[model samples]
Target chain A: MSAPAASLDAVRPPVRTIGRDGRRRLLAAGLVAPLAAFLLFAFAAPIIWILGYGVADNELASVWPRVSAELRDGGDELPPDEAVFAALAADLRGSQASRTAATAARRLNYALPGGRSLVTQTARALADRQEPDPGGGWRETLIALDPAWGERETWVALRQASGPVSAFFLLSAADLRLGADGLERAPPEQRIYLAVLWRTFAVAATVTAAAIVLGFPVAYFLANGPPALASVAMVLVLLPLWTSLLVRTGAWVVLLQDQGLVNGALMALGLTSEPVRLLFNRTGLTIAMVHISLPYLILPLYATMTTIRPELVKAARSLGASPAVAFWRVYLPQTLPGLAAGALLVFILSLGYYITPALVGGAGDQLVSYFIAFYTTETFNWGMAGALAILLVAATAILYVFYARLAGPRGLSLG
Target chain B: MTARRTMRAVSAALAGALLAAPALAQDSVTVVSWGGAYQDAQREVFFRPFEEETGIRVNEETWEGGIGAIRARLASGGDPGWDVVQVEAADILLGCEEGLFEPIDWDRLGGEDSVIPGAAQECGVGAILFNEGIAYDRDALPEGPTGWADFFDTERFPGKRALRMHPAVALMGALMADGVPKEEVTAVLATPEGEERAFAKLETIRDDLIFWRAGAQPPQLLASGEVVMTTVYNGRIDAANREEGRNFAFVWDGSVGSFDYWVILAGTPRIEQAYAFLEYIHRPEVQARLPDAIAYGVVHREAADDIDPERLPDVPSAPENLAVSVTQDLEFWLENAERLTERLQSWAGQ
Candidate 1:
């Protein structure tokens, strides 16, 4: 077998193992331990805490020891919780406590919107009831009454419930199920976030795909072209990065607005009857995003393509392959790592993007990062915001894993 | 052997406590505020004066980064970062709800009479005053767009308008456009139908508006003629009109008034110093200098007397401006902010 002769040198380890190996290994371990500890303490621990905070109230934490012990010793979970509910029922049933019940009933009545008196309804149920049914579980009772229950979902949910952490938030981001009972459903009055999440993904993916498709050919041309022209092409790519992000986004707004430069030019050339609604729509969003992120894709792809030998295509052609076949089979395969890197890079960057989308994108065009910001700054709902961030990170991690698997070991070099 | 180990652990804790003894004893007060001109003015008028009067050192911090930064410093489970924090009135309400801020001692704040009568007894003391108003390009309009009514009359105006897409202010503006009386805003918003009505009203000019979310964009958009008019911070408009030579005019009519206040965070170590700082900042002479620097109003009523009438009208202290502005119901905003913002975001995103 004609094994590649150069493989022998590549197989050799750069450094030999000796007395120094243990000291080197020890130093490396020492260096990494603090980093790992810092990451856990600073980043991971807080994230876990934030995720746990959604369902776990501080009062629950205070009672955790008793609660856990009771659960472990086979004490009833629902009965104690239902005891509170029964006490609430009893309090509501008491004629003397009618004012409080009426007040709560009035509040619930407002929510129901012109429905019959809530207190009267509760009274009827209480009058009809024999004993308050505290079932084997709170889940069972909540499910029975709500019918959003008894689905075997919460048990699987609890197991899948993740951590001191959860996927409830990520599920909430898409307006999906946290459990059988605890779905993050938008009210009938409010619009669903599931569509919003889908729209955001579609917009981001479109922007990334557009950038790749538009940027790839330009990058290829620049990569294979003469050095001076290549430098000029590189300048064209680098120019936008030097400008402020707001400035670039603003420029797009000017170019795409109803009476903007592009429309004015088009009108002057008699292309259409009126200016187009280009500035504050998905078109404007994709245009601005692609303009800004195009360089990100091109630079990586150009770097990868430039390093490929021109002779590979020539060699393939010389070996009896057609020019198109030679180029596609020989040259294109070499650039897979770059394409993967650029696509993933652009996709992830586009997902968390804020300024460009905010500047040029309309209300419907904004991505999920806008909501993350909205929650953090406006609502100050740190838990929800943290949960959204965790979801984005999880989604990105899953994507990276997916990409890594698709690309194989050598393609992992893109990272 | 285990008992000895436990004893050692207890001794180490005691040593750690002893190490922190001097810090516990020291009469140091920290005040946290939004940094920039505001911080500088507070340092000059409030902290420096208070420190000078009492000989207690004032440590100042900025609210530029993370809220957790403040929380973590406070959660050392002892003395917190700030004796006083300059928080938005809505944030002060939330902080009070969560037990994050101390209740103001009304007697300590000069029995609610020394400050503006209606303002002093709230969860916070009004420190800086501002209003949300329409800023229009004078050159573009030709006929001046004077009020929120004119702002929504896109037919006459016939130009793209921008508004800060913040739910609270935007919804309020929509209600004003829908002709809800100023005093009834909170009461009206309390009802689900009223909220739906406001959202529906905003949907009218939804296409015409280029929703600006950042503080900087409205002014930039106005200047660039991308938006001929915008609802923006009065100071941003005032600064652009005066300094940038932008042909702009701000109409205070139907503008919602807002104020930033100083409040003591709960469990602060330096309550006395915080009180001292508050008293210092509200002094008329000390408060008068702020309008010249930042163009926002100081809450000191007497401070307006020193400011020129021409200047005061454009400043938040102006009597004309005050007449046109409505006081924002912070408590109402506080209770409804979360659910309202969520709904608003859902609607806006659609």
Candidate 2:
């Protein structure tokens, strides 16, 4: 028989090791280079930079460079000395001229309550004066200008804010603060974010659990039932994919309002006498969020369940196991990975929900995302928002790793 | 079709004039404001009249862009394209401090005394005044409330009521309901006792209060009877009644009002034209026409007298409404809003 050239090349066994094959390795790297660069800059870098704002304290540094630089070397316990005071006076004059005094004042105000008056009032008084003496007069003159200027807390906040970066936002996000000794829980009256975060986690977990319970049986039907009916039901399940979130949310608002169709139907059936409280509460939020999140859980689970063969359960049933025993022992165990994955996906996605909760939830039902939005839009406090978002993303990333390990071969396949 | 054709011709003509005779063309400055009915009202009264009175062409633009837009322009260091902008009160205060707006030429634009209180500013003049007040469906709560005090009295007008989610208005409404004088609302809120009192008042009916964030939610809530009354922007109620024939009315007593100011961007080359346009717009006759078209009141103090008596109770800036209204303290809120909101949030969650 005449062997072709391809057959002879396939039989050759003299190939070098992959490590020694520099050209192949280089070609492989070149193929991946564009994607690697894109992710590094587009995805990874921005995330890292934003997360850095949690600990990065740079308000005073940006607006009052001289004072920030001076305070970097000074003791936190002591009030800013005459030299630091002179730097501050000079910086305030400079900041006022440059129109940045408000930015610094606003930032300091977050740290020391109502501290805006301290910086702005001082700036106004200092703006009207002649140039500072750059001597001992700054400490006294500044205090004379505003008695609050003499307070230790103002100096401490100034020193704290004078940063390359610090843990101020991160600590504040946890409702903890850097006290005299170190980090301490904020007073009971002011403590908020920890509760908000707990509420956020609890809501996400509840939504995840509910989605699984509702979605699993449907997923099994789609996996095992007649093809045409399964496909149609799958289409119904996925109808939300094309609809906008606001539209879906608005649909719930229509269906679940006090005088809406849901109540009307129930009343007509004589199921209830009065209108039910469905909107603007936890019940409304869960119903809407679960409806929106169900597709994410169902599709992944259906995909995983379809791959499992039916013969194992049949074999177990024929031998000795009852139907329930066969399903529990043989079928359910096989589906655990899919269930965990679906639950995780729903949980992480639910954590980022903002608008649905805002529209459907009462004030008490609002999650961490609400506080992030409040900080961003209402207060324009980017540091606080960044801290909250960092915490949220951190929680999501950890769960994602566990998911990746469970769905190892098809780790990135969403469906 | 004819209107579109005319607009196309006007835009073409304006473009050609810019390219062909850039120097010789009449001075035209871009004025940006919050668009829609407000801009339409302005076009009829201010822009059209100013263009007719002076040979200078008027270029009108509109934006809801906040102070950051101005900051972007400043950073770019070019001709600030928008010569005169209608800015929110907070932006005016912040921008004026930053010297982003030109000092108002009080003499050229008539005396500063000509404008209403809070309308006259260091760098800008108030363009319009709008109010947020307690509103109810006349069909639902026909008795009508005397003041904010009646709003909190669930025993009296007892039904679910909504307030804007933010602490600012709700706290003010609570304090006013609890018998703090409307004029003293801001002063009382300055002290810890005032904040404590406001929250305590809120706590009495805390479980009963429903909070809404969107401006549109209030009217819907009222129409559905989910809420009997709500803290609504007066314009929403006015528009709802006019558009949907839903008879809603504002309890104008003890309302919260704020201003939108017309400010000249600092270092504008068309300073002359800007001041002229501003002066023209603020004329009592011109200012008087705005209230008829929209619910907002005029900025000129004398303009209040010119507004038709029929529209008095409907407008937020009317002297009758203005008398009982409280202007939010920009300086005080800037200092305390964050902490107080945090306090309110912790309280709400509990």
Top DockQ hit: 2
Tens-digit lDDT track of model 1 for B230-325: 888888887887888787778888787788877787677678767866776666656765776677887766767666455777787666777677
Question: For candidate 1, what's the TM-score of chain A, rounded to 2 decimals?
Answer: 0.67
Model 2, B142-248: lDDT tens digits are: 79777888888889888788988777788898899898888889999888899889998998888788889899899999998889789999999999998999998
Provide the TM-score of chain B versus the true chain B for each model in turn: 0.83, 0.90
* Candidate with the greatest lDDT versus the true structure: 2
Tens-digit lDDT track of model 1 for A348-402: 7888888888888877777778877877776555555766666666666887798
Pairs of residues clashing in candidate 2: none
CAPRI category for model 1: incorrect
Q: Over the full model, what C-alpha lDDT does candidate 1 score relative to the true structure?
A: 0.67
Q: Candidate 1 regions off by >4 Å?
A: A1-171, A176-184, A235-278, A315-326, A393-415, B1-30, B43-59, B65-70, B113-118, B266-270
- Candidate 2 chain B has its poorest 10 consecutive residues by lDDT at B16-25
Off by over 4 Å in 2: A1-42, A131-136, A179-182, A398-415, B1-25
